[model samples]
Target chain A: MDKNKSINQSANKNESQSENQSRYIGVNEWKRHGFQALWALVTNSYLLGFIQGKIYKGRLKNLCVPGLNCYSCPGAVGACPIGAIQAVVGSWNFKIAFYAAGFLVFIGALMGRFVCGFLCPFGLIQDLLHKIPFPKKLQTFRGDKALRKLKYMILAVFVILLPMFVVDILGQGAPYFCKFICPAGTLEGGLPLVLLNKSMRGAIGWLYAWKNAVLLATIFLSILIYRPFCKYICPLGAVYSVFNPISVFRYRVDKESCVDCGVCAKVCKMQVNPVEHANHPECIRCGACKKACPVNAIR
Target chain B: MSRVFRSRRIGILLMAAGLILMGFGIHRGEMAVVFGKAVNICMECIGIG
Candidate 1:
């Protein structure tokens, strides 16, 4: 009788412990989502632009937001960092994008990829898409490590190199990443403006079709995987990731408290082993590992 | 220096550098350049033109 009573108590304790852990994770997720939504709304607050089908042309547009928000987004009051960089680099007069580069350095030093985790509108979209209750969600796959490096290449070739070297007759270069890639631009800027403006509808051609295809692929892939764009394609994410290790706000694993249970690794959507790589460039600092750590080791 | 203090120092230095760079850019009228690009609808960004 005593044995059975003890067994029941132990079972109850285990259940309560799991409930507590899940509650902690839930709170963190809510906080992150709230912050992301607030930032998105704050940055893209020009509601009249959406209704009137015009881009915001306020003085605030000179400032670059930390995430991959499109400057051409109908409601965006601030410019995108990547877009701003490409613009200055591609200009006939400027070889260096000092303003945009400064903004990136400031944000990266302050929070690293924490912007990706808790500020980016597109990141919030991916998080929502990933929560659609799909079966067989893939956390990692073949060539995942190799594929992760693709974002850096895109940053180098499309955002920086092509925009710097490739020029038109007037000696001005094109925003290659914005023109050829960037699903955010398509979803936020292209579709809305085209839908609202009949003239823009007539202007739609092969390029718009190509961008739509890319956007479709991103949307579907986001449903299957966690942040496929951030992990594989986003140049902004690539830039911020470089600062993750030394950023002011970063993860630190407490050696004395960690027990090697591997729970944090299992819960991490980014596939980062926080115990081994506390501030891994891949880690978005989403707080999943910290919340999942049984001994409260990660901070 | 300890790891935390070292990380904080680096972050502060980077922040200062970024501020200085931004100030220089502003002095050079790069803000106006950025404004010129951002105020207009970027056809390239929308994958048009």
Candidate 2:
């Protein structure tokens, strides 16, 4: 009986140690998620915008925030960089989008995809969807290498080229990405506007139906996939990723005192191998790897 | 390592140039047009345009 009790005690000790280690590794990720949620709330805070069911039309609306927020969102105080770029590019006069371009470059150079991981409302939604206790479908293989290139194409075609080239008889170009593709616009602007305004409800047509369908698909995919839009379609993320190799705010790996145990790679939701590719364009700078690193090699 | 340093230098220089051009654009009343469109509800984003 004493031998059996000793065996049970040792087993309990091992189990508790394992649980503590797991909790320690996950604590940083929980903290980072909390911070992301807080940042999203702060950025989208024109509380009256939602309650009154009207967009804020103040002077602040002219500026662009460093996230993929929809300008037409009831709570949005700043313009969307992608939408602003489309507007300037699509104009008949062929004016350069200097302010919008400069803003993106400045922010991208400073933070890289840190903005995507932390400040974007749509990214927040995707992260929450991924946490919904479902069997997530992650493409963490050679296919992801090819899939990562898709966002650049979307950026070039939908956001820039199509908007600049395609025109109506009046020579007015359409904001193609926002009009046909952006689930952010559909959720933040379209759904709210239609629901709140009686006039907008009467005007809901095929276009509205099409956009809502796209939004539904995005929501469904996000539940099973980690940030499907940011992974494969976000033009903004593509632009920011160009600066990942040199962005001021980026991950640093300590090679001197390092042992590559692959813990960082395991914790990363973005599927980046942080030990070798610490600043890979796909790394969202979420700091999960830093927390997961057993040897404290990443900072 | 030196190549990475050079790339960062060039990136900073390019960002500086972009900011300068943006300043010039703003001075030329381009901001007025940008802000004019920004203040209005973007019908195109909601698929109306």
Candidate 3:
């Protein structure tokens, strides 16, 4: 009788602990979502620009917003870092984009992909899309690891090399990523402008059609997968991931407390093993691992 | 040095380097270049071409 009572008591204790942990995780998730929505609004806060169907033309536009926001977005108060870098590199003058590069380095060193987790408007969009009830959510698939490396290639070829090499008759190059790929540009800039101004609607052509297709695909894929763009396509995420290991705001696992339960790995949507690789490049620092740690091993 | 300390030191150094590079870019009028491009509604850049 004593043995049975003790076993039931232990089981009850475990159940209560699990319930508390889930409640804590829920609170953290809500807090993160709130912060993300607030940051998106703050960055894209030029309400007048949206109403007028005009881009912000202030000196603040000189500064980059450390995310993949489109500067051409009607409500954007600041420039996109990737677009700013391409402009400098693709310019006929062919000078280094020191300000843009410096801004990236500083932000990366400070927070790494925390910007992806909490600040990016596009990241927030993907997060919200992924929340829509779906029949199947794929955490990983075939070629996932291999596909993750493609963003680095995109960064090199489209953002850097193509702009530096491929020039027009006037020795000017184009922002190829924004021109051909960036769904954020199409969704945030192209769609709104076209809807608001009849002149912009007339200007839409094959290229606009292609951009719209890409945006639609991104939206569709985001419903099934978590941060498909950040995982496989964002050049800015590539830049920030490089700094994840050494960034000031990085993850640290407490060796003494960790019990090798593998809970963190199972909880991590980014597929990072927090116990083994707390500061993995793919970690957006989403705190899922930390929240799911039964022993509070991750910090 | 301990790992944490070393990481912190490297971050601080990188931050300083970034600030210096930004100041140099400002000195060389790159801010104006970014501002000029940003303020304009480049329809081609957004794929309305």
| TM-score of the A-chain for all models | 0.91, 0.89, 0.91
* Residue pairs that clash (backbone atoms under 3 angstroms), model 1: none
Where does candidate 2 stray beyond 4 Å?
Answer: A1-28, A139-142, B1-11
Tens digits of lDDT, candidate 1, A1-299: 99999999888876766665465444248778988999999999998999999999888998989888998899999999899989889988887888888889889988899999988999999988888778889989999999999999999999999999999988789999999999999998999999999999999899999999999999999999999999999999999999898788888899998866667776888999898999899999888888878789998
Q: DockQ rank, highest first?
A: 1, 3, 2
Encode model 3's per-residue lDDT on A1-299: one tens digit a residue. 99999999888876765665455443247678889889888888998888888888987898999889998998899999999888988888855789899898999988899999998999989988988889999999999999999999999999988887899998888889889999999989998888888888888899999999999999999999999999999999999999888888888899999866666777777898888888899999878888888788888
- Decide which is better by lDDT, 1 or 3: 1
Interface RMSD of each: 0.8, 1.7, 1.0
For model 1, state the Cα shift of residue B9 in Å.
1.5
User: Quality of candidate 1's docking, in CAPRI categories?
Assistant: medium
Residue by residue across A1-299, what tens digits does model 2's lDDT show? 99999999888876765654465555345676787778767767887878777888888877888888888888888888898888888777655677788888888887789998887888888888877776647546567778889999999999889888888776667889999999999998888877888888888888888999999999988887789899988999999999887776678799886655566776777888887888999988877788767679897
User: Clashes in model 3: which pairs?
Assistant: none
lDDT of 3: 0.87
Question: Against the true structure, what is model 3's DockQ?
Answer: 0.74
